[model samples]
Target: MFTNTDSLLPRDDVVKFFEDAKTLLELRQDNNVEFWQNMDATALEIWLREDHPDKADTLNSRICLSALRELLSRHLAKMRCAAEWVHRIFEVSISELKSHPDYFILFSELCDDHPELLRDAYIHYGLAQAVQTLMARWYLQPKAEPLAGAKRALPHTFVKASDNEALARLLSRRWTSGDRFYADRDLLRPVVGDACTERKVLIFTRLKESENDSLSLAFDRARTVIEQGPRTSRLTETFADGLLRLPLTSSAGYLEHVRSRVAVLYLFDDRALFVEYPWNRSGTGHQRLAHAYSIGDKALPVQGTDYPVEQYDEVDTLFGWQQVYVPELPEWAAKALAGPSVHVPTSVRANS
Candidate 1:
C-alpha cells in the first residue's frame, strides 16, 4: 500500500534508508533484490549513506540498521519461503534486535508508520508508550487565547445595545418592524392558518430586575398580537426565566453564563422563539446589552465560540437559580440540573 514516508523521517539519510527498506518489502519486479543477497552491517551502512556528503553519524546508522532488521523480520514472518533473502538482508538475528540500543525507537516508529503491526501485543505496548511521551511533550507547550475580534460570522440573528434605552428601542423596533403586515389582521393567523388544534408559543428570556416592567410590556404586546388569531383553544405560552445575575467580566464567568443560558433554551423541543438579553460590564463600568434570537434547536453559538467556553468551568447553579416545570426536558438534562432526590417547589411546578 502507498504511504507518505517523508512525514516519518527528519533527515534525508533516514528517509532514503526507509525508502530502500520499503522498496524491498514491496518486491517490485524491476528492483534488483540480488544486491542485498550478501548484504551485511558494513555494506548496509555504506548503502544507507551512499550519496550523503557528510559521514553517517553513529545514531543514524543504528536507527537505519534497526529499522531494516525489523522490516526484514516482519517480511519473513509473512513469507516464510523468503527466509534466504531475509537472512541475506538482515544478517543480524531476531535476538540481536533486543540488544540493539535503538531497537525500541525503531519499533515504535514502525508501529506508528504501520498501525496494523499493533496486532502484535509487544508492538502495541511500545506504540502506546511512545504516543504517551509525545503527548506529554505537546502538553508542556504554551498556549494563548484567541482574540475576540477573530470571531467569524455569528450563526444566529443577533443585535447589540449599549444600555437600557437602546434595549427598549430594539424591542419596540422588533414589535412594530413586522407588525404592519399583521396590524389589521392577526399574528397567529399566519402561523396556524387552517389548523383547529391547540398551538403553543414558547418564549425564553433573561429577565432583569430593574427593567422588568419594560420587558413585561414588550411581552404583553407580543401576546396581544398572537391572541388576535382564531383558534379552537386559547393560545398557550410558556415563559422560562434565565439567570438573575449577569456573568462577571472574567472569561470564566462569561462562559458559565453562556452555557446556562443556552441550556434553558435547549430544554424546549417544540418550535419556539428564544430571546436573550446578555449584559456585560465595560471597562468604563457601563453595562452593554446584546440580544440574540433563534428557532428551536437551531440557536447555540457556532462551533468556534465553543472552544473558548470549554476552557472554563461550567456554572454550578445552572438550573437551580430558577426552577420551572419542563416535563419535556431530556432525561440527561433533568438529572444534570436537579438530582432525583431534589424536591420541586409547588409554585414553580404550577407555573411550568
Candidate 2:
C-alpha cells in the first residue's frame, strides 16, 4: 500500500501543530466541564502568557476569542442541526483563524449570516464558516450575540470586511487543492480484464442477529451461494433484498470481519470475480421497516406492501449452506479477554 505523504507544509509548522494539540489536550483533561460549559478567555490568555511564553503574546491575544467562537458555533450546530461534535471542530478552525483573523471574520459572516449558502458547499466552507463566526464574536463582542453586535460595532460591514482583507495581508499559507480519488468499482473496471466473470454475488448480512459464530455461518452460506454462480435461485433472491439489522456500533465490527475474510479469500484466486456482499443498506428501507414494526399490531409487511411475505422470510432466506472462518467469539470470551485470562493482540487493524 502506498503511504500518503504530507504535501508541502514545513516541518516546523507540523511540529507546532502537535505541540499545541498536546497542550490543548492537557488543558481539556484538567478542566473537563469548564472546557465545554463556560468560556474563560482571560484565564486561557494568562495561561498562554506564562506557559507557552514564546508563543504567548500571539496565543494569549487570541485564546478567549477562539474559545468563545468554538463554544457558540458548536452549540449552534448541535441545537440547530444534530451534527456530530460541532464544537470541537469549530475550535480547530478558531485556532487556524488566530494567525489569519480577517479571513476568519469574513468566513464567519458568510456562514452565520447565510446558513443556507453552504448547503452545497464542500467541507472547507462548512468547517471554516462554522468556526469563523464564533471566533469573531468572541474576540470582538463582550455582550451576548457578539456576531450580531459586531455587525453594528464597525462603522459599516464593508469596513469590517476591509479589516478582514487586511488580515489576509499577513502570512499566506499554502494548501494543496485537488480532487480526491476514491476507490470504487469503476476504478477497478480497467484492471479487471474481459476474462472476468460477469456475475457478482452481494451478501446481505445483518450485524444485529449475527453472533461471531452466526457470522461464520453466514459467510459459509455466502460462499456456497457464490460458488453456485449468479443464478435466479432462491439464495440469489435472498441475497439481494435480505435485510440485516444489528447494533449500530457492531456494524463496523462486522464489516471489518468481512473485509479481512475477503482479503484472505482473494489470495486463492485472482480471477476477476467480485464476490463480496453490499453493506450499503437503503436508509429508506430501514425507515419503512421501522414504521411497519411500530404499528399497533406489530404485524409484518403484508400483501399490500412492496415486500411480499416470501421475500421477507429470514431463516428460509439465510442459513441455507456455508464455510468456517473466524467463528464468532463469545461475548463472554470478549469479556474474559478484557481480564488477564485471555489475550488479544495489541495491534489494532483499521476497518476497511
Candidate 3:
C-alpha cells in the first residue's frame, strides 16, 4: 500500500475485491473478445463502485484474503501457490481489466495514453493485469466452464510477490546506471555468479544446458545492440530502440530470461546498456537515463494498432542474481567486509 492516506483499502474491502472478481468471472461466457474489450471493467467499475468509485481507486488495497493468501503460497501447484507465506508484498494497480486480450497489444496501447505505464513500480501491475486477463481466457477457454472456474477461486499472485526479506532489499533498491560500487563484492557472486568480477562477466542463467542457447542468444543480441550504440547522441536511445526492436518475444519464458540477463548486464557489467522500457518513472531509479533519453516518458513501441503477446494470468518468479542487493546492501556490505559474521543468504538458484 502507498503512503497516501486516502488510498488505502481496508483489510476486508480488499478481500471483497476478490469476491467481486470471482463473481464477475462466474457471470460471463466471454464469447466475444470485442465485447469485453469495449466494456473493459466498466462493468466491474459499477459492480464495485460503491466500494471504489473507480477501479483505479482499488489500487494499494491489501489482498490478504484467504484465497489471495493461498495464491501467495510458497509452493506452486496447478498454477496456484497457496501455502503459508513467509512474507507477502502485493502492490497492485489496475489489477484486472474487463477484457481478455491483454497481450503486448494492450500494454502498448496503455503506454500510448499513460506515460506512467512503464515505471518499475507499475511494471508488475501491468504484468499482474496481464495474468488476470490470461486467467479470464483460461476460464473462457473452449469446453471450460466459467461457473466452475469461479468456484475454484484460484488466486494468482501477480508480479514478484515474495516471502524473503532478502529480495525486498534488492527489488526496493534504487534503480541506477553508470558505474557504481557495491558493498560486499562477494555477496553479489550468487546473483552475478562469476560475472561479478573485473574479468569479462559471463552470464550463468540457471537454465538447463538444453534450453540455454535459446536464451543465450537473447543476451548476445542485446550485447550487439549496446556495443553498436553511439555514446554521444544515441547511447540510451539506441539501446532503447534496440530493446523495442529486439527479437525477444514477450512470452512468459522470454520475459523471465530477458529480465535475468538484463539484471546481470546492468549490475555486473559497467555499461548502462539499458533497463526496462519506460525507465523508473518516479525519477529516482535511473534518473540520468530518464533525463538523458526520456526513457520513462516515451510511449511503448507498438506494431500497427495492436500488439500480440502471450497472455498469462500468473508469472513464476524466482530469486535471481539481482535479489541479493537490497537498498541498504551497499552500507551493510561495506560493514560486513570490515567486521565479524553477518547472516546473508547466498543464491541457491545461481549455478554453483
Candidate 4:
C-alpha cells in the first residue's frame, strides 16, 4: 500500500489530506471563530489580515452607482451595436433571434455574435471589475506590509469567455506566483493560496452561469444556508459536477491539485460544512457584485437577497470520514495507497 512516499508522510499526499481534515475537525470542536480565521496565521496577524484597525476613507458611493450605470450602459450599447453589425452581415438580427432567456443569455448572445466579442466581453467584465476595484483601492492607504494589502483587502470576482483559454489563464497566472506571507515574515503554502482565495467568494448566486460551474455551485450551495438540512442532497450534485469540470490534463496533475488544496466535508450531523471545495477560479463565470451580502451576524440580517444564509453546521456526518477503498490502484504506480490491505498477508494466505 505504501508504494508512493513523500517527506511529510509514510504513504503519499492522498492519505495526508484526510489526516489534515481530521485535524480540522478536532480544531473545530475545541475553538470558535479564531480557529477558522487563523487556520495557519498567528492570532495577531490574522487580526491585521481579517479585522482591520483602520477603515478606508469613506467612498463617494453615490457616484459609484451613477458611474456603474453609465459604464454598463456604454458597454451595452457597444455590444448591441456590435451584435447588430455582425448579425446583419448574415442577414440576421440579435434581438430577433431568440435565446432561451435564461441566466446565461448574456454569455450565449456574446458567443453567437463573434469570438472577438466574447474576448471583449471577458475583457469588458474584467474592466467592470476594475472599475469597482479601483474605486475601493483608491481610498486605501499603502500598507506597512504590501502582502497585507492583498490578504486584508476584500475579494473580487473574475469574468469569463471560454473561447481563449490562454487569455482566460492570463488573469490568474501571477496570483499564486509566490508562497511566502510577509506578515511577521511567515512562510506560506502556495497550494493553500487557492483555498484562501476561493473561500472569500462570499456572494454566491445561482444565476445559471455559462462560466465556471464551480462558482455557480458555490453560490448554489451557499443558498443552503436558507434551508439548512433540506439542501443536504445538493452535496452529491456538487461532487458530481466537480468530477465533470475537473481540468484534468493528466491524472497526476489532478491528484496533486486535490491533495494540496484539499476540500473536506466536515459532517457535524445532518448539516455538512465544506471548506475550500468550490470551482476553478480561472473558469468562465459572471463575478457579480463586489459587496453582494449585507453585513450581518451569523443569523444574517440580509435586506433582500437570501445569500450568505447565516451560519451553517458544516460538519457533514454523524460518523468519521470513510473511504470505500478504491478497488483499483491508480495507474500512476508511484502514487496510490490503501490504509491496510483487507486480505491476509501473502505469507499468512499461503499458510492458510
Candidate 5:
C-alpha cells in the first residue's frame, strides 16, 4: 500500500514532479535527466538526499531531513561504514534503505542533492526489487509490479536501474556455466545409474575414522539419491588431484586407504579435476599432465575434455563430489583410441 507520488510543498518544486507518481509502480520507475533539470530547491533536495546521502548530508541535511531522525539512530546498524566516505557517497545500500520508508525518503533526498549518483541509486533499488519479491512471497504479501521498460528508464537515466541491468547480464553468464561447477542429477544418473543405490555411490566424510560411520550418517540424508539413482561419492581432499599434489606422503596413505575400499573415494570439498600443460614438455608428455589426467595403467591413456572450476566451494558444499571412473572417451577421442592399443616404437636419442 504505497503512493505513486507524494505532492511537495510550493517551495519544494522538485518533489512536486515526483509526487505525480501516484502508485508504488510509478515511484519504482527510473527517473530521467529532464526530471532533474526541471527540479526546484524542494524537489532537488528530495532527490539529492535519497540518491546521494553523503553529498546531501554535507550541504546540511536538506534532502534527508524528514527521515534523518528515525534513521540516524539506526544508521550504523543499518548500513556498515566503508573505509572512505567518498565510497559511501557513491554506493547506497538500497536493501537497508528500502525496508524503512523513512530511509527511502532520505535516499530520495540524497538522490536530489547529488545527481551523479542517480544511476547507482536506481540500480540498487532495482535489484532490491528481486529481493523484495522473495520477501513478499515469504510473507504472503501481494507482489509489486516494477515500472519496467518505459523509454525514460534508459541506461543513462538512473544509476540504480543501470546497476540492475549490469547485474542481470553478469548472472545470466554465470548460470550458463553452472553445470560445470556442480554435480547434476542428469550427469550422474546416466553414467553411474541412479545415485540412490548403496554400491553405486558412497559418501564418506574426511573428518572420520570409519568409512562405515560416514556412510551411516550420509544415508540418513541421502535416501532420495541412493534409493532412486546415483550414489554420493565423498572422499577426503587427499584423494583429489590438487590435494594429492601437496607434498605429503601421509596424504597419499590416507587416499590409498579410501580408494582401495570404495569404488569412488569422493574428493570432499574438492573442485573437479582439469588439465594442466607443462610449459617445458611438448607433445604427449605435456598434454598428459593435466589436473584431469589418468594415473597408472588404463591399458592405454585416454583423452578427455577439461571443465573449468568456478566457485568450487559453493558447488562442493551444495552437492558432494562425484567420482566417475575415466569418462567413456568422448566421441572424437574414442574414434582415435580405437586405432591404437600399443605405443609407437621409437628409439631416437634426446639430441636426435
Candidate 6:
C-alpha cells in the first residue's frame, strides 16, 4: 500500500533541485536574484500563507516549513549569516514551489540529506515502504498447512533480567548499542535467531507505573523488530496495570477504577505506530491511547475485525471497562483495563 509518491517530493526531483539550487546560489550577481531576500520565521510564515492559502494549513506545508526552519538553522549555525540573507536564498515563493513537487525534497536534501523529514515521515515514508514490500512477500501468500500430527506444546522458560547486561548474559551474546530511531534488517538478527526465515517475533510491553520509561523501551523494541523485517514482529503497548496483571485495589470499596491511560498499536504493514505517547507529562497516557484507537484501521484496526485475535489483543467484553478479556493470555476480570475509544464488537457488547 506504500508508494514512492507518498513523499512530499520524489527522490530524483529532490536531488535535481538540490543541484539546481546550488547552481543558483553560485550566481552572486544582484541581477541574478532580484526577488531573493532574507526574512525572519514570522515573515516566512506570512509569505507562505499569502502565496499558497490553500496549502498553508496542510501537513505537507507544515513539513515544508519544518524543513525550511532546519535548513535556516543549520545555515545560521555554520555560516553565522544574517537570517534575512538566508531567507532570501531559501524563501522562493511557496505557491511556485507547489508547482514543482521537488522543491521541498530539494530543500530537505540541501538541509539534511536524510530521506525522511520528521519522525512520522521516517515511519510512514521510509519504514512503511520497507514493511509493505516484506508483507507482500510473506503474509499475502497462502500459508502452508502444519504436518498432520498431535503437536506437543513447545517448552518455554521465562528468564528475568535485571538489566541489559543481565539480558545479554542470559542470551549468551554481547549487546551492542542500536539506533532506536530507524529500523534496519541487521539489528534484529540476534532476536530472531537462526531460523529467522521461518519464525516470527512479537514484542509486547505494558506499563503500569513508569509511563516514560516503558514507552521508550517499547519504541526501541519496535524499531529493532521493524529493521529485522516486516511481518517478523508486531509491537503493542498499553498503560493499563491490569494488562500487565498488576494488582489494583480501590480504597473507596469500588470494584472498578476509571483512570485515563494510553495504548499504542503498530501494524507491520504501516511504518508509524497509532498512538503518540506524552514522554513529559503524567496521567494523560490513557487519553492518548484512546485517541490512537479512535483513528480507525488506516493505521491500526480494532482487534478481531481487521485481523485475527493475537496474543496481545486487549478487548472489553462488556459495554465498558467493567469486564475485560485478553483471549491469548486467557485472563478475565470484572475490573479490566480498557481504553476510552477501544473498538468493541456488537456481539461482544450484546453478550455483556
- Measured over all alpha carbons after superposition, the RMSD of each candidate to the real structure, in angstroms, is 27.5, 24.2, 22.6, 24.6, 26.2, 23.0
Count of steric clashes across candidates, in order: 0, 12, 10, 11, 55, 8
Best by TM-score: 2
Q: Decide which is better by TM-score, 1 or 4.
A: 4
Winner by lDDT between candidate 6 and candidate 3:
3
TM-score of each model, paired residue for residue: 0.17, 0.22, 0.18, 0.19, 0.17, 0.16
**For model 3, what is the error of residue 324's alpha carbon versus the real structure, in angstroms, after optimal superposition?**
25
Which ten residues in a row are the worst by lDDT in model 3?
Answer: 81-90
Q: What would the per-residue lDDT of candidate 1 be over residues 181-262, giving only the tens digit for each residue?
A: 1010012222222221111212232322233322222121110001111221111111222122222221222322121112
Residue 204 accuracy (lDDT) in model 1: 31
User: Where is model 6 poorest over a 10-residue stretch in terms of lDDT?
Assistant: 220-229
Q: In model 1, what is the error at residue 299, expressed in angstroms? A: 36
lDDT of 5 at 270: 20
Which is better, 2 or 5, measured by lDDT? 2
Candidate 4 residue lDDT tens string, 1-352? 1223454233232233224333433332111122222132222122222322241111123443233334334443443344333334223433343222221224445456556545655544443332223222222224243343232211212323132232222222232211111111011111112223211211111122233432322221221122123332111112322221111111122222221122332111111122344332111110111121212122333445443232234534212211111112112211111122222111101100
Cand. 1 TM to true fold = 0.17
Tell me the spans in candidate 2 whose CA falls farther than 4 Å from its real position: 1-289, 295-338, 341-343, 346-351
Model 1, residue 265: distance off in Å is: 4.7
The whole-model lDDT of each prediction reads 0.27, 0.29, 0.29, 0.26, 0.26, 0.26
